[model samples]
Target chain A: MTNELALAALGDPTRRTIFECLSDRPSAVGELAQLLPVSRPAVSQHLKVLKDAGLVVDQKVGNRRIYRLDPNGIGDLRDYLERFWGCALTTFKMKSEQKGQE
Target chain B: MTNELALAALGDPTRRTIFECLSDRPSAVGELAQLLPVSRPAVSQHLKVLKDAGLVVDQKVGNRRIYRLDPNGIGDLRDYLERFWGCALTTFKMKSEQKGQE
Candidate 1:
């Protein structure tokens, strides 16, 4: 379920751009907005979705909120994608085995 | 762009369910519909979206179309996620280096 949320959060191109920007460095909403084409409020909205999806985290720093990628969230998403590949390989293995039997 | 499309394609719960079912085994539209709670036409529509995203491929067998996970598509998504992690680590490294210089 959480993994689904992360995927959904990343589905939007704007959000993905915001995520990639954060990947380079943690920044406040205004800084992120200046870097991207979107407004500061838009950045905040996207950050909220990313936070809710567990893909990003924010910390209160000197009256400003700084956002960065959440390692745990990234790990969760990576694990999910890895499991998906594993399942696909397993299906292939089963098919090969069935062919051997035939 | 393709990765974004794939992510958007899987944003829905029903679509995710359909994807998980396909991960288990290749199945015809009728078979997938039977396994899922949705109707056959609905399944077909979902399949179309999945196919467009390059996550699933269909092969015509007799009068039926068998759908299975596309390894290339899965590979592309996995690559994108791995790159994301790499970028994060790079950012951390750069930050550490700057701190060392200071």
Candidate 2:
């Protein structure tokens, strides 16, 4: 369900870059803004997009807002893929069994 | 790498449904068309998109084309999420260490 949110969040090139930057180290709004071509407010906007999608978490350490990847959200994607694979395996097994009986 | 392909492939609602159909069992183009809301050609086109994205594989069983989910592709997505988590954990550890030193 929310996997759609994750995909759409990452659909943008710049958001991916911001997420990549966070992967290295959780940084402040100004810090991330300096690294990317986007301004501070834009970075904040992108971060909001990521957070809402459950991809990243926001922390307030003192006056700075630190953003980092949320493992649960990323893990949710893995679970979804696994479910997909599980469906495939079940199908394969059922088909092969039908063939054996025929 | 190939995940972008997977994402774009699933971006379409119809393509996702067609994939869901295959998840149950591999079926011919005509079979999929009958089960779906679209024409045989449209289903064929969606299957082509899915195949190119590395999400599904095709096998010719006699005169029919059977489609199934590619486990390797779905596994690749799981691995990608795991890598993303690894990056996040590494960053968290580094940040905590920095705070300890201060």
Model 1 stretches astray by more than 4 angstroms: A90-102, B89-102
Residue-level lDDT for B48 in candidate 1: 95
For model 2, the local distance difference test gives 0.79
How far does residue A11 in candidate 2 sit from its true spot (Å)? 3.9
Tell me the number of clashing residue pairs for each predicted model.
0, 0
**Candidate topping TM-score:** 1
In order, the Cα lDDT scores of the candidates are 0.86, 0.79
* CAPRI grade of model 2: acceptable
Docking class of 1: medium
Candidate 2: C-alpha RMSD to true structure equals 5.4
Put down candidate 2 lDDT per residue, A1-102, tens digits, no spaces.
677677677767688788888888778889999999989999999999889879899899998988878867876765775675677766666777999999
TM-score of every model?
A: 0.85, 0.69
